[model samples]
Target: MYCDVTKEQDIGSLVQSTIRLHGRLGIMFCNAGVLSQSMKTILEFDLSSYEKFFAVNVGEVAASIEYAGQAMVKANSRGSIICKASIAAGLASDRNTDYVMSKSLVVALMRCASSQLAPHVIHVKIISPGPVATSALCATLGMGADDIESMFLRMFRLKNDGVLKVKHVADAAVFLATNSANSPMSNKLEGKVAIVTGGASGIGEATARHFAVHGIRMMVIADIQDELGQKVMESIGSHKCSYKHCDVADEEQVKNLVHSTVQNHGRLDIMFSNAGIVSNTTQTILELDFAEFDRIFAVNARGMGACVKHAARAMVELKIRGSIVCTASTSASSGSERFTDYCVSKHALVGLVNRQANSLGCMGLGLKGVTLDTKHIADAVLFLASQDSDLITGHDLVVDAGFLVR
Candidate 1:
């Protein structure tokens, strides 16, 4: 039977009808959502457009959950409610604030419903997709079929593989639905929550995927690259991770990222402040531009500082012995030509880690500060995040293949 989920009566009737026909309600996938065609920024947003987007994206999903959850409770049966969300939920999109906000609200609803319905053994999971070659996506972006292929390649920087297919998302949803209660593998990081900054590509993305593989209950992958971040989320499976667009240079955005993680996941156990940017143009000390220096410090040093501050506060407030890991380069100890500002920014991380370690240690928080490859750094982070490194704090684990020594 077809039903309009936005209509309360339709949702109620659909649930009742399903139960009457099947004798029980086992699984409900609230997957219907809409994206507005108007590419408007926040300042140019129209309230009516925003409402329309939310009505289908957020309102319908919540209504389905309520109606479906009630049916599950009445029947005394275990069930899973999987909501379709987007990687956009976590990231900011240009000229698509309405779509982004609506999807973000969907994620919030899933978290809220998960907690409220846990007593009834109803599992609530959000499947957030990156970019799939769907008709809706093509239509919204006003791209032709050929343009879509090239766009994905350029957006994700894909070589030949790693393009997100619709089947990948379907597989993820099936996994979540089937294993809603218990996972097959014995995950080391099970029941823990984490936040990974710069998680769109390279080291940050690798670390997020590693955390998910280790069985982290939830991960907030924060990055400014929406498409790349979504790709990472898709690869990791949204059952374990979600992407958020965050520019670490912005302190308010960093604070919001941490606050939202804790709000959605209940507590934060690990924070990987791995976002950093280097100066593109090389300049000697005499020729260095103050603006260039400031830009590097903004993200590499100050951004990491903001992340540590908020992560520490959340850990302390919740009485969690959390681990805070920052990315420090070998340049922190050694110097390199044409990278004076980059080296300086990394050195600042070393100092920040040392001081934060001592300060947070007094409050029972762990701070350790990686880079062979992205995976090697991710492994070091995993160790620090796990019980193996519980006694280790205020230390920097450098993974640069002997570059510093050489």
Candidate 2:
């Protein structure tokens, strides 16, 4: 049953009614939200008008979870509650400040709940879908049928050899509700340190903030761009977060950065090898300039290799088993026709993940590969970094909307 999540009394009444009807709450789907249409940019936004959006989109969802989750805990039942989130949580598209801010807060709030509630037996999850053809989205965006279809197609990265529908999320929710143990926790990886390279902008920045929001005390943001790196550090605040400047392609700099992180952060927990350069050329492989290929490889391939090398060494020396996640791309699997240099570099990254996973497996450390969705990659990194995947090592977490199989 769905109820307006914003009203505390309404949420409380809904919980009371659900328990009364079903004897106990089997699951909770915290999915009430509002989208901004007319007020697209922050400059155009009225604070009072936008406050309603936050209340409905984020606040209500959190309140529902708090009330519903406490009920589930009291019942001592195994349950998984899923929340509706969006890729907007990561990407800052033009003219969507209010929507993006609300979605981003939803992610942060859900992560906080996940950590606090995990010990009790209630599982909290967020499903971040890309542009879906929902009536609400269409109405808000004021797009016609053709515009709607085109928007969906542009974001659908996966080959359209198959049909995708909203029912996919519905089915996933059903599974989370019925499953006995969706994410059973072991005490591993608790209180571990993490390093997020390039943790200053784009996907890296989002992932770093996500991890920090999840109670990772020590996070080292290694980036060559000092200004942006420092900005991220400031934005996340300096509790256990610190910034370091390092050209990942240089062996000495990589080594020094890892050393300082270990010295200061105490122990390594998760290594997010996410920094990479995109080639300026958008040409076919045969026509692409050789210099473009070298430039991309130096950063995407050699840079990643250097990161893995030093981070793994620190983990091994400290005798701390940790998970290392490298950012690969969907372009790695197929030719991006226009982005040949970048494509080949991404392909090489997959090879790096495989080889490093094999190499680190012998040392009791874990290596996981991740492909990017320009949005879900941050969430995927959080999933890998969390305590849920203790046994998942040397595996590729493809976040490309199912492109590998397609």
Candidate 3:
């Protein structure tokens, strides 16, 4: 589709033309983006540079999506519309403050739009990529191909020589637009919703009880242990908490749990994927059993990933910037020895935070804490869910009593 995402006249006309030409709109790619003059950091860049950056990068995208969404609704097509975002907001770089800030704003915009547009059966999504090998990017960096390739490999976890192409972006957009995907509506988080991934005990149980007292309306208490999970929910009272058997290690059940939580609660807002198992003894990688190592990684690393992925998907469908608190540990920073399994996974949890934080931050979402007290973490999440930490995103305040600092 011919789209000029910035100009009101152009956007209006593009939507009008789409209806005239195709009679129906299946998807909208709100993909027009730009960057600003590169600089060392936030301090080096002036306010005017940022203003220009946001104008071209963020304001234009929001305006375009707003215009396109109205057209899609008028055509009566439940379509998936994806926007382009960047991972720079999460990862620190040597320069380009304006670009990073602008990208961060896009994520917040997508999130807010996700909430506003979902009622019309329109899905708002964001495709965030790390560094890509685009000629435009190399030109922007003003560096040779070899130097750029080396830098990218050193900086990013997923490093490829290929410049991030427009097609790579297009492919991601296509996936979100597929009609066969039965994504839960983004508006499902507007009202009260209950969630308890590891609600049977520890931090999960504590968070559950805190939310319960504050008025959660409906809840689904999920845990691997049937009796404990059920009993915890029952203790919380049937009117507020209901138990579900979930082992986040199983990807299939993770999907089922999220769907079931949204179904049971009629809405979902708070998700605490706080379930994790730590090895009692500290063993080096060579000393630990493959089985034992796998067990901890299963529940702590991949398990948390599954829970966040599904919960985030549901939250996006509901058009809500829900609070997600993964149970990372003090060991994440200190590098505990015998606890190699725990340390590795907890460290990786921070990586997950950085990735999604950039996307969500642009959408006015905030992530808080790394290893605070259970009650403190609960309060922090609840505080973030409120208006307190609106500007705080992509941050993990380590509550290890200065262990990491030392």
Candidate 4:
């Protein structure tokens, strides 16, 4: 029977009708949702638009869960409750705040329900897909297949295998519903939470994707580029990844990002302060502008310092014994012409890492100052973030394709 999940009465009736027809309900999939066609930034967001999106994206999911839980309990059946969420749920968008917020709510709701319903043999699972080539997404974004593919390639750092399909989601749902054994894939980073700053593109984005493949419990990709960040989050799949807008140069934003990660995920296991920029207008020391020096230091040195400070604070408070990895260039050790400011900033980062390693020693916080296509950097980060590198800290692991050796 058809029913409007947004209406309580309809949900109730639908549940009753399903029970009557099937004698019992074993599986419930709450998949109804909506998104705005026109994009609006946070400043231009319409509250009414948020309300409309939330009614379907969040409200319907909640109602479906309520009614489904009742039906399952009444029948004494062990079943799975699966909800559809989007990559948008985890990523910040320049224009789709409403969609992002609503989708995030769905994940939060399912997490709460999962714990509460576990004892009853009712499994609550959330399926947060990447950019699936669905009619709805196509219509909402006003993009065709070619356009979508091109965008994904340009913005997503991951290898372009193909766009996610509906069948992939369906298969995932089936696996979650039936699987009882602990799969190796699911236990890679079983209970770890990490934050990847500058994760919108390049090495940061690559690290986020790598973590997802290894089964990180959750990852927050923090970057200043909202659009690119969203694409990175979507590319990695929202099931275990999210994006936050953060300018590491802004101490307050860095603090909030770390605190919010801990607040949402209980504990933070890793912090990849990988956001750094090269000077667009390189100049010799004789011609170097103090302003240019300041800008570079703000991000490369001070920004990293802020991230380390906040991440360390969170780790200490939670007694997490987490790892913090900062991105450092070969320039940290060697100087280059026309890159005086950049080299100085990197050297400063090395110093900061050294100091943090000593200061956070009491807290058992490991710090590594380190990259390459980003995949190489990601690999180093994975090791530093894992138990394998617990013995290593306060060192720079440079990846420059033998640039220094040569």
Candidate 5:
């Protein structure tokens, strides 16, 4: 249980013991790492410290992945392998050169590992958190969590002071473990521009407002409801957000929307494809309306694909490695008595996201659903690990008590 990752034998024994106990490894989370106490800049970088840092950060992580991945492959057990990376490395910083370089290498290592292990159906994912008030970070800075968070707000000039939390990081890990998806999150949302489809109301509107609070420089609300979308944009501040009329079901409109945003903003960083609608009818197999089904798919499935395709093209063409998020329902994970059209379209959306993630390393989160409380999530995971959900993989069962609907 208590093993130094720096030791290969320790890692090997740990994996062996884990398999012995659990019969198979379901998840391997390589989260252990040491931060740079010296906070050395590139000018003052030292090789001796770099070696020590590399041993733990890069080397240890590689070892853990190898041991865990091998065990999973040998057992034919498909599982999730997650690693913790930092934004200080990703975004670049003036300090912590050794830490930064080590994390960068870790990213490269996991990327190769992701490709290599994909054949085995193993999900290798990275979570690049901006600044978490971890106990280690607090102790390193000799500051408390509140003080650290305050410092981050002032230092990063963050609009949302509550940007990073331990629970937030833990929640991301849970999603990756359950659904094989994660996001590259940063504390600073400043200077970022986004486009949110269906931003007129509901979850889309709420997320748009939150993005504004978190310091998005500009965001375009694309929706068919011109009046409501304009109202939400005005409420969030027109200087930061603007409303545009674009039906995602229309490929030309989606294409124009993405290209116009990039042309106007100079760069598009986040694409939140949240446009979708449920059928008025029950939509079960027996009474399924092909017309209604096509309508829903046009918006939710084909429309989402168009958004992702154009957004990715704009990002790649401009050489901007941006993030795209698709709003999918938990219903995608399972079948129900009704809303089959809505559920199938969501499944298509999920498939699109997962495909892009594998091929392009897209910044997407698998938020199938979770309850308002942590205990409910733990119970869900427990059931997932049990025989009840043995057939499930890449599934995010919504444990929310009808909150997603209500």
Candidate 6:
């Protein structure tokens, strides 16, 4: 069936036909845009053209979301809804005034729809990507793929190795569409295979069962405790969950654990690296046993790193953009008076998220000034929340300190 996004009836019919064919709506990706627009500045923007552009770009997105969301709700489907936005929505651009404004409105519409649909247990999200060398973009610029890629790299000030691809965006969409990190109340883990380190007991055991209950295809419970791990796996049923003794502190064991998971399941989607250790000796720094500190670091820091490292390796090698979550503690961020070794190790574990430096065209927390300005944003928010931006509807007030100007 030929579907026109601008026609509400067309979108609605598409949704109805989809449900009729699939028996249930599991995920909906709303994508409609006006790509062949004049790259005009705000001052030169034509109101008539702007209205027509929005009808396809923003209005069509709204229509698709409404129809898809209604279909999911009626079918009692707790699925995911995703929309596409661009980095232009967040930054001020020199041209394409109508395109930028439409994206901004699309973002707001997705947020409002998400809020309204939360009660129905449907998850709504957006994927905002930088310049991608899609065919449309290549045609728009009248440049080939290589030329456009080089232009984007220079325009964005990205590193030599950093190249954005449409596949990266699609991978992100696939992850969000099958979000496994949803609330325990939802069965978003459907058809996922997971490896939970330290899954014998405590938080690991609980999460293992929860994943199994939420429709995980396979749950590999890896832990040092053989008997406990076996019990947890059996209780969850051998069909869904299985046990494997893995001392995360040992690199060989971690490597084999991840390898076997992929070998058995064909793919590994979620890696819950929750394995760690606490202090066994005097927790204070003055009396902290050096040997015990080493033990703690072996498990909490080194072991977790090994797990994440191997899992990441497998995922990247297999072209799987999977999720790897390390269960770090509050001590990872804040200093502690006791369990000093434990705190340090947990901080090392958190290096995956917060580091002094980073790679892949992304930098970690670099300057101390950003930390100091945590409280300063409140003043800017107050101004916007007040009468300051009453006239500036649908505008993103960049708080950057003159960086974009340069």
Per-candidate TM-scores read 0.54, 0.55, 0.52, 0.54, 0.51, 0.52
- Clash pairs detected, candidate 4: 328-370
Query: RMSD, model 6, all Cα superposed?
Result: 13.2
- The sequence of per-residue lDDT tens digits that candidate 3 reaches over residues 1-406 is 5655556777778877877888877777776777554555756768876776687788777877887788778878787778888878666777787787778888888767777776776777777765665666667778876677678657643311133444555544554566311333222223467566788987678777767765577778888888888888889899877888888889899899889878766656767777788786678988877787788888888998888788878877777656666777777766755778778888888888877775654443444445653245554444434333333445565433223333
Query: What TM-score should be assigned to candidate 5?
Result: 0.51
lDDT of 5 by residue, 1-406 (tens): 8999888899999999988997899899999999997977888878987898888999888998999999999999878899998866566677888888889988888878887887787878877776779999999999999998888767653211234678767766776687321223323457877888898997678777767765678999999999999899889988999999999999999999998998899998777777888887886898889999999999989998898888878877776645566666667765579998988888877776655553443222221222121223433432332222222223334444333332
What TM-score should be assigned to candidate 1? Answer: 0.54
Superposition TM-score, candidate 2 onto the true structure = 0.55
Candidates ranked by TM-score, best first?
2, 1, 4, 3, 6, 5
Residue range 250-308, candidate 4, lDDT tens digits: 99999999988888889998999999989867899899999988999899999999999
Top candidate, metric TM-score: 2
Q: What is the C-alpha RMSD of each candidate to the true structure, in Å?
A: 19.6, 17.9, 16.3, 20.0, 15.5, 13.2
What would the per-residue lDDT of candidate 6 be over residues 263-347, giving only the tens digit for each residue? 9998876777777777875478888788888999889888877876787678767765455555666555556788889888876
The C-alpha stretches of model 5 lying farther than 4 A from their native spots are 180-406
In model 2, the runs with Cα more than 4 Å from the true position are 1-190, 403-406
lDDT (C-alpha, whole model) for all candidates: 0.81, 0.75, 0.69, 0.80, 0.74, 0.69
lDDT of 1 by residue, 1-406 (tens): 8887678899899999989998998899998877778878988989987777788889899899999999999999889999999888877778688888888888888878887887787888877777777778778788875688677767653312235566666755665576422345547588999999998988888778778878899999999899999998988889889999899999999999999999998999999999999788788787788899999999999999999999999998998888898998887887778778888889999998877676676676778885342246766677677755554567777655334433
Off by over 4 Å in 4: 1-188, 371-375
- Candidate number that wins on TM-score, 3 or 4: 4
lDDT of 3: 0.69
| Residue ranges of candidate 1 with Cα displaced over 4 Å | 1-186, 371-375
Pitting candidate 2 against candidate 5, the one with the higher lDDT is: 2
Better of 2 and 6 by TM-score: 2
